[model samples]
Target: MNKLFLVPLMLLPSLAFAFPIDVTKKLNGAEIVYNTTTISSNMAAINIQNVGGTAAQCRVVFVNGPENPRVRNTVVQSGSSSYVTANFNRAVIRLRITLTCNPT
Candidate 1:
């Protein structure tokens, strides 16, 4: 009986999911830099850096499949950095992000 159950488990294929991330930026010459990092299966973060001479106001949107989009806004001073994060109720198989910025 134990051998029969073990034999069926050995025939099962590996269950793996590659959670890829895609980012689209609409920054219009604001001298801003950003990157998306996956913190876990249900959480993510965005790091924004400003390397310009003026402050930048940025809007970051995080999208997970079958969930409402998460929006975050922040202002980064010149030569400074900030981070915006999102926590989802469901596991994130893939992440989509839109980053928009303007010089303030």
Candidate 2:
């Protein structure tokens, strides 16, 4: 029935916006790129790429409500990419990520 189909269609938009992700980056003259992805309700990952001629050292911090902030560090080689992940103890309704990078 058309009414049944409409019910699912309306939910499609809600599912797409179930969670929101915010990213703040501080790249000091380094050609760095980052992308975020949601793995699950309590997990997320960030993909970092270095496109400059020099290597880069990056620190990533993930914060969720009422949970200890998760921190990760990685060195990305020129023309390469790396991933940083965080798993929280509670459902992540909102996620905040901070990325800081410097040329090495």
Candidate 3:
């Protein structure tokens, strides 16, 4: 029916915008910016930036509904940045990141 078709069409828009959760926080004199955005129907992008005068280590994990988990480790030097991507056979549901930065 027309109503059934419209239901799925309406949800398509949400999927297009359901990506790239941006997060920014200040820790130990360093500014950490992290984002997880959808790259495709089965892939997600991870980006991290360290804006300060120290080095940082980050551990990122991406979890889809019931797929295998993907984890990544990255190091961002002072006044530098990094980027990576996590792939899933399905859509991602949640993302978690842990950052360790040097003290002032």
Candidate 4:
């Protein structure tokens, strides 16, 4: 094969392997808990915790929406458990969370 062709071939694998993991959080009286796990080749899960005060509210958003980002039938509350799952083709995922206290 030509040298130029060889160079391109070598770079193909690297492209497929380029994945990223990103996360962000904000405080809202209650402590915010976040976590991620790789369940399979193209599947992963995230768990969030609301540990600040009673009646605290939490919301999650995907800055770079995943191929399939859905709530994984879980809830995270103080003294309890809550989580969400995200599935993507690439390795990089970005998300943000906001927590709020009960309105006075």
- Residue 7 displacement in candidate 2 (angstroms): 9.6
Q: Could you tell which candidate, 3 or 4, scores higher by TM-score? A: 3
Which candidate, 2 or 4, would have the higher TM-score against the true structure? 2
For this target, which candidate reaches the highest TM-score against the unseen true structure? 2
Q: After superposition, how far is residue 91 of candidate 1 from its true place, in Å?
A: 0.4
- The sequence of per-residue lDDT tens digits that candidate 4 reaches over residues 24-43 is 55544556566665564445
Clashing pairs in 1: none
The lowest-lDDT stretch of 10 consecutive residues in candidate 2 is 11-20
Pairs with steric clashes in candidate 3: 20-37
Which segments of candidate 3 are over 4 A away from where they belong?
Answer: 1-30, 93-104
Residue 103's lDDT within candidate 4 is: 14
Clashing pairs in 4: 20-92, 30-52, 31-52, 75-81, 75-82, 76-82
24, model 3: CA deviation in Å? 11
State residue 9's C-alpha deviation in candidate 1, in Å.
15
TM-score of each: 0.81, 0.85, 0.62, 0.49
What is the TM-score (0 to 1) of candidate 3?
A: 0.62
Model 1 ranges with Cα > 4 A deviation: 1-18
1-104 per-residue lDDT for model 2 (tens digits): 89988999898855653478899999998999989998877889999999999999999999998899999999999999999999898889999999999999
**Backbone clash total, candidate 2:** 0
lDDT of 2 at 45: 94
Candidate structures ordered by TM-score, highest first: 2, 1, 3, 4
Candidate 3 local lDDT, residue 95: 45
